[model samples]
Target: MYHSGRLGIMDDGQSTVLHDSPLSQFADQTAEFLRYHVLSAVKLLEFRRIDWELVGRLGQVDRLQQLLGEKFRLVLDCDAPQYYELALEFHSTFQYIHIFNMTLPQFAMATGFYTQQEVAKPVFVSLLRGVMKKQQDHCVMKEDLARFWVTIATSPFSNNMVASDIRDPLYRFVHKILAATLIGRHEDDNKVNHHSLFCLMCMVEGRPANLASIFAWSMTRPKKGGGKSRMFGGPYITWLADNLGVFVDYPVDRMHTGPALSLMELKSFQQAGIITCDTPPAWSSIVEGPQVQPPPGSAADAAMQAAIPS
Candidate 1:
């Protein structure tokens, strides 16, 4: 029923299923993509900007707009010709539905959204639904997020992934810990950190690829709380750069993935833009960073406190 019938685009909104039509193929591909990719309940409308950008790039949007402008009123105009009536409605929903046949790269490029070859992280889905604007090319950056990151690493930030003592904003941000960028008084700062989904999850290929990697910046460490126990074991610092992985980078080395970096090496990588601010491995409960827990009275609370390394 959903084939050419319900959509109102191809066959005048009449309930007829043409099993081998272009519209049917487009719908099938779209449904298959949605079924496997699992956008986590985001509506199809969320990706309309991508299709708009695609047609814009193809230089065919003018014709599309012309069709829409002239034909759309036929849905409502009481005295309009029957040939251009409600049966042939023109809507953005149809636009979104019709264009899902584009490849993943084509669909993802305009929004700077992507995923790894393996491992379907849910965060990426959230971001795809969130970034409403279109970025030009996958290699290009939005700039403001980059500036905001530089500002953040000026020192000490928080994330649930890294230890409280490891206040390296670079470590936190790169690891997806900071969640969103800070936007505050920055009259003198060149880039006022405006936090949004578009900049946060950008997976542009290159050095400092995503917002996470761009902010992989750190500052000199301080032995805070007068404690001397050192932190260890981030993606081990020796894994092949080609095999190593971060949030959006592909060819993930899952087991050797954490970057085994500590305060000193993190400072070094921060300068080179290899690491980012800290975020807890929200996926791993075996590890802990900053988190909200129940009041400190239950046995569970006691266990959590004991798990904290000295």
Candidate 2:
């Protein structure tokens, strides 16, 4: 059934899913759902699923209907496609940042220390240790995050892996998700989720969050796949080159940074003391290739192409 990774049935059966092919959930996602609802290039990105519960359990919490929520939306009618592309970038960015901000400490324990030998060990390690101490019950304070960003942003050990590209947008996004979401009636806004913020910072840069090139995409996205091949017009690249440039000068920076790493780098980062793994992550070599999907179009498109089955 997954031969094409999509289903063509049009009936909106109670269990049937309304999917976007290329399934824009921004398109082409998991095969378990119906994949016949391609609308247009300018489509809506409904809320996403986190799948926190244990795998292989029966009954999903956010059934198809729940994922297609009623409140938030991003509609592109006459808006330039550049904005549309930017929206996609933010969507990916939000997912990654939230996950990391919540789990800041745990992530630090694992991949945080291995800064690729970029910094003076004593100075950098001390800063990293102080940063790790800020995690209070998995959630960090707003100031905490600010300092955190500074710690990594100033360090060469975390380049490209934590803060993504250029750092400004991530500042805005971190506040939006981490600080904003935890806010409650003024006096009670504290506890946040323990997260892999480093991983997320890398993602915010526009390429999918590959995490030292060892993790699978959190879900299917950046369908272009990450690597030297995936960098040309990625969201972050466009942002820096098209919008602003600092240590990065668009094409030049693009070439300098090299493209996103492939799965092979996982083995490269497993230094004796750095990664300290007895066994490799099963996901290291795994890469998500885009799947064959339903054609991109809307009902009008189908009608126009319809040679009704007489």
Candidate 3:
């Protein structure tokens, strides 16, 4: 659904399904690629921008079709008379449904808006039912909600069996921790860190061929407060690179995957326009010519604390 339906321009604002269609086989293949090769929920969420960028790359229906030839069968419905009406209906529901539904109850719970549970439940349910009715009246709402609910429940971010098979797991069997952070943020307001996802997009844009590899690198390290002791893994480093927009052209030892970048290489990477260095950290004493400072609360600090345990 994500790769073939959501990413495809032809399927935008259209009915997206996973069963019994020419696109089904291609959807299955895309699912397999994510399952067999991708790492964790964090990696998946980190790559969400790439998904959007891919759609942007093929803005027009014909262009998308050309780029994704034989990958799926897509029939664009540009002339569908119901499109405008359905769009208006969906927008109206989006505006009013939250007043009585989970938004209010969840907000109350989260923000202490209401201390009494009994008062919130019935109100929330009543609002949710009304919203559901409105959604049913609009074809777009029905389709969009179905797609959103399906992915929300059964996506790689879920704890279901579908996510466990992914090659490199994180958080010791848990799912959706880091991924949900960004996904939830995106669903709510459309901006997250601004630094993180943007950097990931730029890196992938810089070297499209190394996307999967970089994704793999990102999964190797779980995010902070991940309930795991170890820190600064391969994937985390990659994420840091994207988050900071730092060009790390380190020496690629046989065992090391571009680890230990030299000062000159770092400068060259910056100079080559691989990354935009905005207010990069400045160093006065240059024993190494360009010193690399570890991020706060990193693995080294954690290890040192463990050693002392004071």
Q: How would you encode candidate 1's per-residue C-alpha lDDT over 1-310 as one tens digit per residue?
A: 2333222222234422223223222243454333212211111110001134433543545643443232121211111111111111111012332355543333333222233531155443332221113564333333533432332234233221122222332233222211211111111112222232123223211111232222111101111111221211011111112122322332232211211211223333334333333451111112233443533453435667789999
Better of 2 and 3 by TM-score: 2
lDDT of 3 at 133: 23
lDDT of candidate 2 over 156-188, digit per residue (tens): 333232322213332322322221111101111
**Where's the lowest-lDDT run of ten residues in candidate 2?**
71-80
* TM-scores, all models, native as reference: 0.17, 0.18, 0.15
Q: Candidates' lDDT values, in order?
A: 0.26, 0.26, 0.25
Ranking by TM-score: 2, 1, 3
| Top TM-score prediction, candidate number | 2
Q: Score candidate 2 by lDDT.
A: 0.26
**What residue pairs clash in candidate 3, if any at all?**
217-235, 218-235, 250-261
